[model samples]
Target chain A: MSSLFNDDSLKSIAEAYEKYEKELVPEWLKKLPERMEEFNTLSWIPVKRIYTPLDIKDHDYMEKLGFPGEYPFTRGIHATMYRARLWTMRMFSGFGGPEETNQRLLFLIKHGETGLSLAFDYPTLIGIDPDDPMAEGEVGIVGVSVPTIIDMDIIFRNIDMSTVTTNMTINPPAPVLLSFYVAVAESKGVPRHKIGGTTQNDPLKEFIAQKSYVFPPEPAVKVAMDLIEWSIKNIPKWNPISISGYHIREAGSTAVQELAFTIADGIEYVRQLTARGLDVDEFAPRLSFFWDSHINFFEEIAKFRAARRMWAKIMRDWFGARKKRSLWMRFHTQTAGVSLMAQQPWINIVRTAIEALAAVLGGTQSLHTNSFDEPFRVPSEFAAKIALRTQQIIAYETGVVDTIDPCGGSYFVEWLTDEIEERAWKYIDRIERMGGMLEAVKKGFPQREIAEASYRFQQEVDAGKRVIVGVNMFVEEEEEDIRKVPLLEFNQEEIEERQKQRVKRIRSERDKARWSTALSNLKRAASRGENIMPYVLEAVKAKATIGEIMGALKEVYGVYVEPPIY
Target chain B: MSSLQSISEEIKAKRPLKVLVAKLGIDGHDRGAKVIARALKDAGFEVVYTGIRQTPEQVVMSAIQEDVDVIGISILSGAHIHHVKKLMEKLKEIGADDIPVVVGGTIPLVDIEPLKKMGVKEVFLPGSSLKTIIETVRRLAIEKREKEKLLT
Candidate 1:
């Protein structure tokens, strides 16, 4: 690498900086007193008032950041980026039963949502049928309940499975849900290879952040790999795993931690898949990521830029991946739900817009801007529409999409990107030294880190160090006194009763002999260390309920009991 | 004996105020529950937190086994009405009805009254300060102890 500045020139510049600081700073300080405060990023990275070439003096332009679409794509993965095509506005939508969720999906589609993201209810997420005793009140509460193949069919009833890409935010039971999607697509005459979307078959993050895990870590990851292996052969268009850092950030880890832990989990997944005799290039291209666009505007942008660069290095240098596509780190960004406040709900709109803009500047491939009212309940229709419009305004009106990585050459952005990447790499190194993410998780390293970060943040908020508009500073005397925000109401008892009846009907209506045979085959395959995907697909086709399939697997793999961390 | 001495004696004789912190139903979002657990622990309460996706029956059974002074249920999945109501019924069925239940999470304003009517002693919605939650739990624990003494 050619040096940007010679030794004498650099020394001259350093001397000049020292002279300026010594002479000019004192004069300026006397005339204009500086604000008496410590400045830092939301993640607590110290910030200086001004950034210059001195801050990035060590930056090797061609090595640290290359041309967009080149190796180590710090600028962006694609050369043209949004100039060629805008990022997909994939709004995450789901609530009540499949029918209701289907309507929401269509509503988003009608409002120019380019892609669909499905959020399964608690019962579905944890691999339980709606009628299960444990699933009683939770049915269709948080997300749509998909208990059987029929429910999945209803959810995607008229939507063309081949045309629209879908993303399912699910794990642990991801394979079962993916099997149902396949069954739905096949029944719709869509070819298996033509089916597209991603299932969040990331079990490691579930242990780290989201606690919707079913089996033990080893077996759960085995199941995730099973889906990845199956997707490589059959569903070429499908991304089998979306290694998620979104939930990690929501669970209160700093941006660097989210990046590192998520990448480490990706590394663990890659290791497991390669150990199963799969080629790195074959499965690597299908590996995608999910990230959170938190309120820290510049920090979030830097985090995303750093993520792409780090991922490229890991894939090419570490994993020896040769495919350029394999080296590209494609991710979906969701605005941080934890940043939304229930106090001044309307202010959340501004927060979401800023977060979404950061994601755009960060070069996300897909984005989901969270609704303002999400802190209270499921977003009302008006709120969801406004959230979608937030993205539209950024894309069409803001002109941010006109350029490719507009912030690429900014000194502050580049410096922050390097800093975040360095910190994240250190975390990755620590995890690697601990024998990787699984061991780290087993020792509750990430969990305790997240808990501590969460507690510290709460303390900051409570102590008035951090200002949350209406939460701590401008406190609302009474809810009624504030602007009336409409709440999304769902008839819980009605939804639950209808879901239970549907499950019961499906149980009675399906060919019991076929269901039993398929379930037995699944249980046998799960027990004998065979690939469980084919059997799971067969069971789904046989109309086996999610709980039944998960129950059989649970009998084999056993449930995970998380070690108490906090 | 002096009142302070008698109070200290009572506190020494009694077990620490045990609070069962639980997430009932399928909501895997337990950041609130976990935060509350840590805060209560810091405030000198022994908190037994059941991890996410716990059924109401499981929560009630655990509460009974732990013999908790308070049952703090955190539900962000928007099923608080159904879940908390069923939990209240389950506690009644098990005859552990004396335990005061405090609910927290993103509860709707309209549902707050109904949740309280379902025997939830307090409802802490989103943006509820940690100090507020801690103070509420402490006050509720004392009220429960006094009521138990009267019943005895």
Candidate 2:
């Protein structure tokens, strides 16, 4: 491959850079010494004062960064990008009972939200009914509680499942949740092929970051892959797994660790499918991703750009995926929740705005700008609208989306993009040598790495090496008391009681013989190493609660116990 | 030496304060719990972490078996009200309520006073400095140790 610039041109640029650094830098430093003793990114990647073409002189425009929507998609996956259609504004929302969450979904759609992302409460997330002793006070505390087909039907009662794409943020028992959704859609006259959405079925990341694994590693992954295989053959439009880095970053890994570990997880999923003698291109097109757009402006943009380029190469070279769609890395980005500060709570709006802009510039297919009041409680109605408006202002007023890949050729961005990609590849290779993400996670490699990074970042903040505005720097006096903020509060007991009653009603009214047969069939299929999606759907349609299905599977797969580690 | 080091040495003069750091209920967000656990351990205290998804019964049992001076519950699930109530009841049932308990995470300020009234020693919200957490834990540990001596 030939270089983008001729040698003579590159040599002259290098000469000019050297002359300016040698002569001008010394003069400038004498007048105004650098503020910090050392300059580094949040991930501790040492950044130079300035970048020049000489920094990326080895780059070839064609090989490194082709036009948008092409192989090695360094720019973006869509040629027209946001100029043709704006990114989806999907605010991940859920609270109270299924009816309440359904109301919120309608409200967001009325306010111009392009997509839906549902957050399940702790019990539903872990595949337990509200009445479970383990679920006492946690029924609908953090998110919406949906433990059966009845709740699922109520949650999507009015919404058109065929038009608006929904993303369910659940793992481990993802197949069960998907079954509930599919059964609900089918009841509404929506065919399987027409029901388009995504289930965050990536279980590998659960063991690494989210800590929400149900079954042991081997069977946990087997169940997740069952969803992917079933979805590919049954529901063509559905995205089975969103290989996610958002939870990884929230659990406190650096941007590079998020990139490397997430892609490695994606590779493992692809391998699982192919090991079953399935074609890579058959399912690769539907493999999507989720990322955390953090506060670091340039680094977050570069991370997104690098992620697309890296996945394209991996799919083509390693997996031999021939189709362009199979190689494309489509992802939804959420502004970092961990970055929001409790002090000067209103300033969180500005933080989220800045982070949302970075996601747009990074070329995300969908975005979720967090509410300013997230640090205090679940977002009030006022806060959710503000978050939605932030995305609107960026799309309509900012004019950042007029052109595609706005930061494509900036010297700093390109260099950082390459730097992040190279470092991420090293981590991926190391995990591959350890026999992929499952083995590495079993040995607690990524978990330990994240713990170390989180501690180091915390130390930096505590020591004042890092500035978090109201927290460490600027030292706000008499910060606003968070209680005064109009926060959303839930009647936990009432919600739990209502949900448990619904579960009981559904179980008692349904045909007992069908429910029993459905559950037994599910357990038999799971035990026999067969795909359990059809059985789960049958159970869900037969009015079996999530807890019953998971219980039946538990007898076969067993529960995962996390080893103690700091 | 720094004041933190001096405090660590002072605490070590008698014995390393055993602290049991735990995550109660089904919440999987353990970043805050792990960070606080490591910080306490680094401050010359012994920290026994009960991984994630432990019920109140398991935590109380661990505290009594470990014989820790302080029990720090890190929760972000908004289920703090339920978990803390159960935890306090369990500790009282076992007559181990003397161990100082500190709660931390994305706790609403409105809930702090209620939590404190339920026998919590301190409520550490976000933006709480490690200095404050460490010093408070040490003071609580000293109080618990004194009570133990009196009882014996």
Candidate 3:
């Protein structure tokens, strides 16, 4: 790779920078005091007062960051980018029962949402029915609860499955949810290949951050791969696994850790698929990523750019991917929910808007902007609308979408991209040395790293080193009245009661013989180490409840107990 | 040397405060709970974390077995109202009701009063500083100790 600047030009720029820091900075400090004693990005990367060509003197335009949609796609995966078609506005919507979540979905679509992102309740997320005693007090609390295929039907009622793409944010039981969705789509006469969407079927993240794993790591990964293998043959348009770093970042990893661990997880998935005798290009194209657009604007954008370039290189060079589409690091981004504040909750709107803008400039294919009030509770209808509008404003009014990779060539951006890429590659190399992400996770590498990062961040906030507006710095003498903000209210007892009764009714009404047979077949397939998707699809069609299907698999696979790490 | 001796004596004289940081129900979000556990440990308290996806019964049993001074419940799944109510019931049933419970997470302002009425001593929302949480837990532990003395 050739350097962008010649050795003489680099030396001149370096001398100029030193002169500016020594002579100009000292002279200016006499008249104006510096804001902070030390300035750093959120990831603890030291930030210079000003960036110049000296910062990126070693950068090569072609080798480091090629043109948009080209090899090692640092600029972007798409040539036209948003200039041709804006990124998908997929606002996450779910609360109460299926009916209520369905209503919210319709509301978002009516207000110009380009795609749908479903959030399941805790019970459904962990692959249990609402009626389970373990699921008591949790049914339909966080998101929509789908205890059976009946509930799935109700959730997608009257919606054209063929026209819209959906993303379901569930893991561990993602196969079960995917099965239910496929059954629903089939019932609606939508062909399997025509129905497009993504299931967050990444279970490695479950152990590392999300903590929603059912079986132990080895078996859990097998089930996740089952979906990927099934999707390649069955649902061509569906993304089987959205290897997510969003939750990892939300669980408090740094941007580099998020990028490194997520890409590592993606590599693990590809390794598993290809090991199954499937070609890499066949499954790699559908493998998508999910990232968090955090508070730091430039750092977040650079993280995305670096991630795309790294994944493209990994696919082409390491994995020997032949197709261009296989090398594209297509991703969906959600603005950091942890960045939202409960105190002066409205300020979260600004935070979310800024984060969304970073995601757009960073070249995300799809974006979900969290509502300002999300830190307190599920977003109210009004708040959800505002979040969707935030994305729309960035797309239509900002004029950023008019250009491709708008921040591709800035000195600071290029430097930050290189810095983040180098740092992330170090972590990936470390994980690879541990054998792979699965072994790294079993050894609690990422878990411990994330925990330490989280604690350190809290310490920074507590010690006032990091000034969180309305949290550690700005004082509100009197609490603002939040009564005016409309809150989403749902009767928990009633929702649970109705869900329980529905589950019972489905069990009683379904063909009992077929249900038992389908469940038995699922268990057999699960124990035999065969692909469980076909059996899961059969069980869903048989109206076997989520609990029953998961129960059968649990008998064979057993449950996972995460090793305690502090 | 005398001051250091006094500090050592102070540490030896009192039973170190023990707290159980737990996540109940199907909520897998434990970043806050884990952070609180570490912070309390740094503040000279013995913190026992129950990890994630723990049931209310399991949490109460752990509290009894650990003989914790306080129980801190961190829930972000918006299931606090249901989980906290069940937890309070379990604690009472186990006769550990004197062990004060401090709830934290994405708790709504509207639900705060209800949770407090249901015996949640303090509710910490998203922007709550670790200092505030540590101070509140310490104060609650002291109150609980006094209440146990009165009952005895």
Candidate 4:
């Protein structure tokens, strides 16, 4: 058997692949891989040499891929992919106080960033102010610490709210922060429909990774749906929810587990809406996803391609979305934060570029490439520019985006895409058997799966089977690791001083009676299971501090403690 | 060099060693700490991992409550000067001044000399190999165990 499978046969096989390479690959290509196969993340499936009619045997270009903006959306979402308009280049920016974050946002816009992606500090994420005792030295430490409508106003200072598509990376406090944004927009005479942006109202990922939950999973989902329903009717151009696998992957989930958990979450959301007597088409179109482009280049590309096809199938055959837009998966991709290492930190730039390319090939609407020094510290101006410029070079010079779904018909791509679909569907079916994502998360199915994947990867590291260059191998002897750099330290005195002014100003001013009424209304809304967005917006309009509104609501919902684990 | 011999001698004599792996302050990057935890655990020393962002008070309290033989605090956030200084001060107040602390994370070579004078047994920064971290923990655990036996 070994002799039969020798290079004699394999060499012939390799030659056979290149025999018809001119037809499959562009005629200008001199060399094309014949026996070289493509592999997906799971590392089992092998893609064929060339894709032809036989590969997508049942595929109808119109019915499957169609034109841009058409059904199935295997191509781009818009009628033109960068012909009419380029993809939104939103750099995820926010650090320090509202004023400092405002400066960063202006700097990003000045440097060709098309939109905003705000990263709030932990205090704001947990629905507290910088003045909260738990805030400690963490106030304005990692990201911008937004505490109230005042902070929001100062953060967006001179930036025009009408044109900028600002994405807020807040989950547990999304409803509250979104309310602040709406009030600010209304204050600026910007129509709700004209305000195009997204709130990452993805609370499910919070439970598994992120660990940024305010309420338990039960109420978290309810609040997420609250945003979904509210955004569809009120903030028409806004995406109510961005179902994310970014944090899930960042938390150490494998590619298939990320896909399974993410889609399962989306399915549960749709089911919840359906149970509420809302039609699938009514809110499904506004649903968006955020994915992570990991270091596994081709695998990441295949994952994205598989995701589009899988979502389309789910919308059509499973949930039944009548509209084309409803089936389309419009998602933003960020380079894997987990992949960035502190050792030889500059190498992270190379890693991010490769990952970002996967995102582009995988058909991302917007992308955020991780900074080279991000793992060491929050990105300085020098690092962030390189990250942004990387995407610019790829988009302008790379020619990979010239065709629709450029990797669409490669045998390796199709095979790998199918393999990913197969593996992911297995996990997806398992989640379904366990009663979907919500119950699976409660039972710790996804977490356990991620833990297992993380364990195996660790074993591989220990055995030196997989090399992480600077980490596991290729280390330099007597080479000094740069520990201290001029990091952007949060000014503690300034924070304390600012907190005092904010607390005093809020207590002294504002319509006391109206604020009290809104708080009472918010409490009632939370208690009665009414959509809390409208009432939250009412509180924001009254200039109710984020703490006051959140505290009033927390009294009703109650605080939660995570399960103790080893 | 003689310290390594005495520690190994105690270990071969079947003496149990205790090592407490902890985090001081709000730095939550635990990959290195957790890996060290498992490595120490697998290396046959009793280990305790203090979870998440903790105050120095919590660290000192855990060290006492766990009756740890040696304490290792891993801090990634650049608040180490304030946190480690506070922790050392609290240790003196609690009369656990002789309790050894192996510092980890972001500790540059220049900071290491100062840290050693302030009573840190060793400083394991980013570039240190996993094997070296395990070996140091083992040696420290043994040395602490042997010293306690001498007192008894």
Please give each candidate's TM-score. 0.95, 0.98, 0.97, 0.86
lDDT to native, each model: 0.90, 0.92, 0.90, 0.77
Model 4, A395-487: lDDT tens digits are 899987777678766656665666777889998899899898899889878866765566456655666655677877976554455444334
> Which portions of model 3 show Cα errors greater than 4 Å?
A1-3, B1-12, B147-152
Error (Å) of candidate 4 at residue B101 is 4.5
lDDT digits (tens) for residues A311-377 of candidate 2: 9999999999999999999999999999998888888999999999999999999999999888877
Q: Which residue window of length 10 is worst by lDDT in model 3 chain A?
A: A477-486
User: Candidate 4, residue A472: CA error in Å?
Assistant: 3.1
Residue pairs with clashing backbones, model 2: none
DockQ of all models, two decimals each: 0.61, 0.79, 0.73, 0.27
iRMS, candidate 1, in Å: value is 1.7
State the local distance difference test value for candidate 2: 0.92
Q: Residue by residue across A133-229, what tens digits does model 3's lDDT show?
A: 8888888878899988889899998789999999999887888899999999998999987989999999999999988789889999999999999
Native-to-model Cα distance after best TM-score fit, residue A272 in candidate 4, in Å = 1.9
Error of 4 at A106 (Å): 0.7
Runs in model 1 with CA error above 4 Å? A2-16, A23-36, A481-483, B1-16, B93-95, B148-152
Interface quality of candidate 1 as DockQ? 0.61
lDDT, residue A10, model 3: 84
Worst 10 residues of 4 chain A by lDDT: A35-44
Which ranges of candidate 4 are over 4 A from the true structure? A1-71, A478-493, B1-39, B45-55, B70-92, B96-129
lDDT of 4 by residue, B100-138 (tens): 888887543455787787778888865455667778877
